[model samples]
Structures are given as C-alpha cells and as structure tokens.
Target: MLKGIPKIISPELMKVLLEMGHGDEIVLADGNFPAASCASRLIRCDGHGIIELLDAILKFFPLDTYSENPVSLMQVVEGDPATPTIWKDYRSAIKKYDQDFTSFEMVERFAFYERSKKAFAIVATGESALYANILLKKGVVVE
Candidate 1:
C-alpha cells in the first residue's frame, strides 16, 4: 500500500487519476447514476459516500485553477420536489480544499450524463443523496 494515499482510493482509481492531465475531468457519481453506461473509465467505489470520496480525492487531486468553474453538479429538474440539501455539504467540503472555489456549475441532468461520457473517469459511489454527483476538473500540480 502507498504510504500517503487514502485507502479508499483503489488501485484502478489511482491509475485513472494519474493518467488524467490538466483540464481533464472526473466524476463522483451518485448511486442512481448510470455509471456503467456513461463512463469512459469506470471505477467502482461501492459502499462509499461522495463526501468522503471528495475529501480523499481533493487531498491528492488539484482543482483546475484556470477554469471559471472547476466543479460541476447535476442540476435538479424543475418541480422535482427533491431538495438536495447535500449541496450545502458539497460546498463546505469544496471550500475546505479550494479556497477559490465559489460555486458549482449546474448542468442539466441530460447534459451531465453526456459530460460524464467524456470524463477521464467516473467513480461510482453508494451515496443516496439527491443530486450528490459532482464533477471535478484536474489542474497542474504546482507543489
């Protein structure tokens, strides 16, 4: 096992992260996301929540500082009646890692699925929160 790497990060996930370059994006998919059908490279992270995975990933993966919105989320459908309180948690976690992160770029549900198809990889998690899926853009490792 790696000394500093988070145990939650599987080898396959680590490889995908390493292969990604600046501007590449990765998605932390929610339980209901069609990961198998949309992902170019799918990393199964069953039994995990997006929040924990987000924290672990941000520890190693740098956010794209050049992008106006380095983060994106699946926008809730109108009149869906599903209040995604989880977004508040996501905002807090993102701010903890990226001070410059202001807000999430809300993508239409269908657009989010299309974007997932082009992502470098998608980490499928067991999170059951509504609209919990998050996309993160990779940035240069300056340190």
Candidate 2:
C-alpha cells in the first residue's frame, strides 16, 4: 500500500487517475446510475458513499481550469420532488480543494448518461442519494 494515498482509493482507481490527461473527465456514479452500460472504463467502489469518494478524489485530481464548468451533476427530472441535499455536501467537499469552486453545471438526465459513456472512467459507488452522479473534468497539474 502507498504511504500517503487514501485507503478509500483502490489501486485500479489510482492508476486510472494517473492515466487521465488534461480535459479528460471521470464520473462518480450513484447506486442508481446505469454505470455498467454507460462507462467506457468502470471502477467499482461498492459500499462507498459519493461524498467520501469525492473528498478522496479531490486530494490528487485537479479540476479543469479551462472549462467554465469543471464539475457537472445530473439534474433531477422536472416534476421530481427530490431536492438532492447531498449536492451541498459535494460543493463543500470541492471547496475544500478549490476555494474558487462555486456551483456545478446541471446536466439533463439523458445527457448525463451520454456524457458518462464518453468519460475516461466511471466510478460506481454505493451512494443511495438520488441524482448523486457527478462528472469531474481533469486539469493539468502545475509545478
């Protein structure tokens, strides 16, 4: 095991993060997401919550500075009453790494799935929250 790496990150996930280049995107998929069908590369993080995974990933993953919205969240259907309070938790976690990070771009449900199909990789987590799926764009690491 690596000394500084978070125990939550599996070896395969760490390798995927290392292989990703600037502009590539990765998805943190909720339990409800169709991860298997949508992912180009899939990493199973079963029994893990998105909030904790988000926090752990941000420790080493850089957000795309070139994109207007480096972070994107799946939007709830128009008539759906689910408020997705977990989004605030996600925002808080992101702010810890990037103080300037504000809001996430809301992508339509179908669009989100389409985007997921093209993502560099998708992490299927055990989070039960509705609309918890998030896509993070990669950025170049600065020296």
Candidate 3:
C-alpha cells in the first residue's frame, strides 16, 4: 500500500530492508532454503521470483561499496564456471539498472549457508530455479 514501492515487497520486508544498517547482510533465497531455521527474521514473497524481488530492493537500497562481497552467489558444483541461467538474468538486471556492480563472487555451498546464518534477515522468494540464492549487503546513503 506504500507509494513508490514494489508491490511484491510486503510491509515486513520493507521494514527490515529499511531498518538494516551498514554491514548487515540480507539473503534473497530460493524456495529450497530452510527459512525459518536460518532467518533471524523471515519475509516471504511467495508469488514473486528472486529477480522481481531484487529489482524492487535495488530500487531503494544501494549495494555496499565497503565490502568485497557486496554480492555473493552459490557456486556451481566442482569447477562448473558456467553461470546458471538465473544468474544470467540477475546480471542483465544489474546492467539494466546501470549499477556499478558487474560481478558476483562464488562461494562454496556450505560457506553460503554460514554467511546466511549471519544475515540480519532472509527474504525467501518462490523462485524454483537452481542456484537462485543471492546475498546483499546494505550500504549507507551518503548525503
């Protein structure tokens, strides 16, 4: 019901994304994630895919310039450098937004889980695509 906000983002998600400070990480995860078990706070955007959620969030939140891992993705198993189709879409979306962010570093699957454990909140999307999970770091808006 908020003006200038994506309808896909629920009020709870909006609150978490807005309230998160610098150094806080937010996970936009696939449907397979154990959201309740891992999330300190869980925001479910059931009908929306990860790309839609990312588009909405990036509209307001800037990627953290302070961290090398401003964006991180789960790596393909064992030397498979071929990016997943979902990741290609994400890259295109980033380019469309004219963001300076060009690359997403890959992390081991377990490492991703460890990182997610430390996230402030996890926004679970209904994306069925494999390897659709992404972690975003919140950045400060400098005046």
TM-score of each: 0.97, 0.99, 0.91
| Better by lDDT, candidate 2 or 1 | 2
lDDT of 2 by residue, 1-143 (tens): 87989999999999999999999999999999999998879999999999999999999999998999999999999999999999999989999999988779999999999999999999999999999999999998996
Query: Residue by residue across 1-143, what tens digits does model 1's lDDT show?
Result: 87989999999988988899999999999999999999878999999999999988888899999999999999999889999998998899888988888989999999999999999999999999989999999999998
Residue 118, model 1: lDDT of 95
Model 2: CA > 4 A from native: none
Worst ten-residue run, lDDT, model 3?
93-102
User: For model 3, which pairs clash?
Assistant: none
List residue ranges in candidate 3 displaced over 4 A: 79-83
lDDT of each: 0.93, 0.95, 0.84
Q: lDDT winner among the candidates? A: 2
Error of 1 at 46 (Å): 0.4
Alpha-carbon shift of residue 127 in model 3 (angstroms): 0.3
Better of 1 and 2 by TM-score: 2
